[model samples]
Target: MAGLFATLAIRKALDKLSSILPAISLLASSSSAAAMVRQGHEQDLEDLRMLERTMHRIHATLKDAEQHWDIRDESAKLRLKGAQGASV
Candidate 1:
């Protein structure tokens, strides 16, 4: 169904987001902001702020997905294959 595909797309996006979050978080802290300012990298600080906002939005989407998503074996395997291909 259309709804299922949309759910799958959201799941795929979340998987991608999850994989990248740690790297983003490492660069998004208050200390990191201060370092960027001291180094005169205002753009980098702004980028970190953007990443934090993006992560918050994704987290909210994830909560919604948890409530509404239907996980079936077939779809899960498909998502796994897609992730594996992306890693290559």
Candidate 2:
């Protein structure tokens, strides 16, 4: 009779564990998915930062070119005016 009682107790514990197993599995999967999403977001932020830096460098280069062109245009105009005055 004692052996039968031990068997019955073990079976009851197994039954309870079986009922709880699905909930544990679901929690584990959800945690894993959340970690993956967080990692993806971090990677995207890093890419955006790199893109912003590249754009800033490009803007600076364009500004420098514009300044150079403006100086050249002014020099050409001065030369044209000087030649006209001499010819007159």
Candidate 3:
């Protein structure tokens, strides 16, 4: 029963995370696109380009973090199973 509760909690947390992930991604994508649309001279353009790169980097970092969480969650499930097996 405790194990079931723990699994439910983990799944709930992951579901919340999954819901927010797309909003974050869309925000990043839209911001990047907006930066590209803004007018600028050579120097300004360079700066905007840098901003775009930074935004992309941030997006990529978020993606990596989400992937890491997924890996951790999967590992947790495997560990939980192993623990249950031992108990049985």
Which one wins on TM-score?
2
Taken over the whole model, the C-alpha lDDT of each candidate is 0.53, 0.47, 0.48
- Provide the lowest-lDDT 10-residue window in model 1: 79-88
Candidate 3 is scored at a TM of 0.37
TM-score ranking from best candidate downward: 2, 1, 3
Can you write out model 1's per-residue Cα lDDT over 5-87, one digit (the tens) per residue? 54466557657765776665555553444664645544565665665566556445544544555546668556544533443
lDDT by residue (2-83, candidate 2, tens digit) is 2233334434544565565556545545555677775675565556555445444444443344344343476744643443
TM-score of each: 0.39, 0.41, 0.37
| Candidate scoring better on TM-score of 2 and 3 | 2
User: What's the TM for model 1?
Assistant: 0.39
Worst ten in a row by lDDT for model 2: 1-10
Worst 10 residues of 3 by lDDT: 36-45
Pull out the clashing pairs in model 3: none
Deviation in angstroms for 10 in model 3?
0.9
Clash counts per candidate, in order, are 0, 0, 0
CA shift at 19, candidate 2, in angstroms? Answer: 50
